[model samples]
Target chain A: MSMPKGSNIGQFVVIEEGVKLGENVTIGHHTVILKDTVIGDNVTIGCNCVVGVRKSRNQNMRISNSSLDPLVIQANCKIGNHVSIYSGTTIAQDVFIADHASIRENVEVGPGTIIGRGAIIELNTKIGHDCTIQTLAYVTGDTTIEDHVFIGPCVSMSNDKYMGAREYTLKGPYIQEGAKIGNNATLLPGITIGSSAVVGAGSVVTKDVADFKTVVGSPAKDIRYLVSKEVSEHDTTT
Target chain B: MSMPKGSNIGQFVVIEEGVKLGENVTIGHHTVILKDTVIGDNVTIGCNCVVGVRKSRNQNMRISNSSLDPLVIQANCKIGNHVSIYSGTTIAQDVFIADHASIRENVEVGPGTIIGRGAIIELNTKIGHDCTIQTLAYVTGDTTIEDHVFIGPCVSMSNDKYMGAREYTLKGPYIQEGAKIGNNATLLPGITIGSSAVVGAGSVVTKDVADFKTVVGSPAKDIRYLVSKEVSEHDTTT
Candidate 1:
């Protein structure tokens, strides 16, 4: 078979056939790009990042069949080292995926979003444009996050209340536009954070948060409105 | 400034001065090794794994400082692609870190251990030798896992009972040698798992588990002695 063409692929870099790559797409050494993967122009994929497809195995049990769809990465995207964009993931244009982030199967990330380092975006999640998902946050399946939202470090969002062994359905949660979720907060499934809402750090959110409201404590109760002072201070520091 | 000698960095890889790399080391493309990190000999660092670290910002708030000390990776280790071994982490010899695993600061992984793919070992935890930490598990801080332990996928271990914003003194919870923890199990702080103990899948363990016993369900109760038949069957399938 003829050698696949790229700018530079270091030793042990595996790229399957039918994978389309745009100009100036630099893939680091030992990176694996599976079949049918499409990468856009000026994209920099860091070393050791696994793109495209994989099978799901559970302790000797083949829990799910192997994935088939190609990963589609848009133009001008900067993917950091060690980022695993799993099968059936579609990353939109101008997205910045930081180091060590895990984007699981069938997840769609909108354009201009920044997936922070070590962030975990679970399967079947839809993240909107211009969102900033911070480091080490966990976004579970069937969740929808709107545009310009900010999720803090170690934020945990759940999909199941009474988690079980077999497959069960829990209603998907929604995080509206411009919302800010604090560090180490847990949001139960089927909840909604309205536009511009703020969930405080370490809070356990059980119910819906109203638009522009600020919630705090366990089973999060609305404390007050989000002050402009806090927002301004946050902007200056960043 | 002159680059540090013996730094086996690949093409398109950048390493700031003062970063030390041992013999026969391979660094993948577009991977950056920041200052003050030390990597040992015969270490296979996979593509896109970020060594050393950076701080994270949320909504302009300097949430938690995720800064770690210079990372030290020991000899004969196999680190998978896209794994993030953060600062202040010391990985002992003969360790296997799978793809997409995130090991945060101040964690010490003993020799001959296997950290599965997508597992997150949080700060200040001590994992013993010859242990198997499964995929997608979240292990919080100050926990002690003894040698020959087996931790299954999606297991959650916390440091606090009433988890809140305040900083509480975290004592080490003990997992004795040869213990086996099942998938999606939750372990509360200050609890102990005795030697050769077994925790079933999807259980919320609120108390201590006795040695050589098998525990299941919420507030994990001892069901019976762990049979060799079950263990052998489980081993073959995984």
Candidate 2:
């Protein structure tokens, strides 16, 4: 274990062998960093977090996760208490992950994303920069989200349309840049949400949305085309 | 600390002073049991859990939670890893609380309930017997839930109608017996979900639902009355 200059680690923290911590790192009590994890400068992790966590697959899970890469957290990230970040993940700089959030393996979180409390980012997902995934949201595996997207509280995206009843290929939703998914919305598998689209609260998106279109209701239908590029201010606060 | 006969405690477990554990209790690694917590016989708690957690109020909050009762867990309950159950809570016997769940203060979870993984049960809620609150569901504060209710994954209930912008009393939904709220459903504040009512997936419920009625869509409308008492088998699996 190598801790660089100005690092302050709390008691009962377990930094395993081959772990490297950069300058000005602050880790709280009972945090566990697994082997070969790298933390950049000015990172602050709160209590009871388990970084670089090893993966354990259930027997019925069909997804192949046999091989995994080491974890990497870039500079100036703020991780809250009771977070569980797995191995094979790379979190970019200036991200704020709130308390009790769980990020699964093989995930990529871009810079300055705000993952709200108790949000679950599943394996093999790619999240772009400056996004907000709010509380209790479930970003399922194999999803791709572009930059500046805002996902409201309890938004659920499904990667498998079959719901694990039979063998099927998994393909999650592809959300383009600046899209806003409202609270309690559900995105079906393999759909594409176009750029700057606005999905209303509690809408169930079943198909592709065009750029700048506003959709609402279940089997979400187009309400109007957005005249401006800016996402709704109400969306970010939800 | 008093541990009854046949209790098995793992390494790094912190059982604080005045805590009591009954016979055949199993506590996993690095779990923290705060002062004066009572765990009954044959209970099992998994790794990294925090039981009997003290509450901290946010500076801007209007609710008063100055007084709290001690935490109690009855026999034969199974608590999963990374769970957080706060002070003033009572979890009844045969309840199964899955991993990453957070139960707040002043809550009551009745017998044979199943709280799914990553579920958040907020403060002052009363959950009755044989209930199932599924994965990623958000049960907001000040709610009253009756027996044999089923809340699906990512279901969100609101307690404040104004979203905290104004001064208002917080009152969550009152869900009666045998109600089934489908996946990603959103229940607005202070509404009564009547007995055995079925709320469909992705619905945004804004009003009172009558007993055994089925409602769907945004600003949810009544579809039909359920003919039977049995909740759909599909609802339990979602």
Candidate 3:
């Protein structure tokens, strides 16, 4: 392990073999950084965090078990207390992961994203830059979220429609750029939320949304088409 | 601090002054037990837990600041890893609080309850015996949940109807015994869910539900009245 010259580490931190830290990295008490992990310059990790945790296999699930790459945390990221980031994940520069959040293996989080408190990001997900996933939201496995998307608090997304009752392919929602999903909304499996679309609070979306559309209610229907690109951009992405 | 006979505490554990542990307790690595906490016989607490945390008041919220009593964990309780339990709370016997769960101050959880992984129980809630609050559920402040109740995953409950827009009384839902709220359901403020009532998955509950009724959909309406107490009991409570 090679520690940077200006790195500041708190008491009881465990930096394992083959781990690398860049300049001015700050880590709080009781944090454990596993072997082969890479942290870029000026990263801040809070107390009791476990970085580069290996993904556990379940006997009931038949997911593939390929050799995973080491975790990578880019420069200027701030990870809060009690956060858990698994191995094979890549967190880009300037991201903020709030307290008690969990990010699973094989995930990629782009630059300048904010993962809110207690949110759960499942395995194999990819989130683009400048996104905001608010508190307690569950972004399920295999999802792709584009840049500047705002996902409200407690939003739930599913990847399996059969929910383990039958053997089915796992495919989560594909949310396009600048879309906004409101609080407590449920997005069913394999749905595509188009660019600049707005999903209303507590809605249960069952179909694909069109670009510049606003949808509300269960089996979410299009309430109105956003009149112009400027109007849609002002209402959602901003 | 007084450790009981046959107590098994892991490395890097911090047991503060005035904390008391009973017979055969097992505490995992890096767990912190604050002052004046009392743990009874045969309890098992997992790694990286913060037990007996004091509540932090926000400058924006006008809530009373009374002196809190010490935390109490009764016999045979199982608390999982990364859990955060606040002071002035009492967890009764045989309770199972899963990993990453957060329980706030002045809460009361009765015997044989199961608080699932990533569940959030806000302050001043009272949950009765033999209940099951499932994963990612958000039980807001000042709520009351009676015995044998089942709250499903990602179920969200609100206490303030105004949602910070205006001043109003904060009163969460009063869920009676054996009520089952399904996955992704949203319970609005101040509503009463009657005994053995069933709120279906993804439902938005706005009004009070009658006893033995089954409600579904947004602005949930009664789908059917359960024929008898035996039928409702068999379907929900059991």
Candidate 4:
């Protein structure tokens, strides 16, 4: 194999043949880039991160594993160290995945989304563009998060009514466009947060939340109506 | 620094000055043993695991970054691959730490304890000998788990009550000896599980459990008496 002139490759990096590496892609020490993984231009992969590694063969466990699908991170995305993006996850252009975040298999994160540090997105979730999933929040399986939504820190989204035992007939909950979920909130399965709705912090959402309304408390009740137009006008003036 | 004859060194593993490796110790690929981290004889470190790496310089993240503590895995302990045993975690002899488990700073696992795969034992939590923590369980800060305790999979032991904007003191919980917690259970803070008590699956324990009692349901109540003597006699006869 011929060497590239003036390229700094760290120790323990396995750059397999046919894997494309963009210019100025700096992989840190002890990081492993497996075969068939593609890196875009100017990507900074930090120390001890594993990219393109195969998932562990243990099926009975639900802990984070490397994805089998081809992971594609678009140009100019900032991926922090210790971030494990499982297989079949496609990070769109200009996305920022913070440190210690775990994105499971087959997730389609749209462009301009910012996944906060230590946030866990379970398998098969589809997040739309420009969304912000905050720190320490958990979005469980098969949830659909629309574009421009804001999920606060430590918010929990559940997929099964019975925790990991009874599978729900329907898929998990859906959060429509422009909705905001507060910190430490819980969203039950089969529920929906309507467009522009607001869920209060520490609320356990047991039912659907109507659009432009703010709900709070356990088994969350509608507290007040938030006028979207008035808020937009206030935003425009400010 | 003179090279010893017939020494087997794995690729990308850096053994700095003053570090000692006993004979027949197998260092897997990409595993870094930093300065002054000692490995006993007959130790087997799996692949892609980082030992004695410097901590990230984040101060307020609840993760202790000072490497003032050295990780000492005693002889004959079987540590699985991809396990991150941070600084200050001491694994006694014959301890079995499974894959993907995170033993954070200042934690100690007694000998013959099997920490299940993907279990997160937070800082300052001391797990006694012969205890089995099941997969995906989270044992948080300052908690003490005594000997022969079985914490089931995905069980969450919380440290805070009156959560989310409530002004309450956050106290630690205690799990006494020979307790068994079923899968997906939640234990509130400051509550003690008496010796040989059994908490059923999917139960949320809000109060202390009495010794040799069986508890079930949400906000778990006492269901029946756990016949400890009878069970012990059956075990002896078998």
Arrange candidates by DockQ, descending. Answer: 2, 3, 1, 4
**TM-score for model 2?**
0.68
Better of 3 and 4 by TM-score: 3
Model 3 residue pairs with clashes = none
What does candidate 1's lDDT look like per residue over B1-238, in tens digits? 3433444554446677778778777675446676788888877675566777654557733222334567888987877666677777789988988677888777889998888778888777899998888657777877899998888656788887666566667654689988887655678888999998887655678888889888875566766433555687789979
Give the per-residue lDDT digits (tens) of candidate 3, residues B47-159.
Answer: 78899987777889544242178899999998877889988889999898867889988889999888867899998899999888866889999999999898877888999
**Which CAPRI level is candidate 4?**
incorrect
Go through the candidates in order and give each one's C-alpha lDDT. 0.76, 0.85, 0.85, 0.71
Error of 1 at A105 (Å): 1.1
Candidate 2 recovers a fraction of native contacts equal to 0.27
Candidate 3 clash figure, as a count: 0
Better of 1 and 2 by DockQ: 2
Candidate 3 chain A: minimum summed lDDT over ten consecutive residues — where? A58-67
How would the docking of model 2 be graded?
incorrect
Distance from true location, Cα of B106 in model 1, Å? 18
Structural similarity to truth (TM-score) of each candidate: 0.56, 0.68, 0.68, 0.63
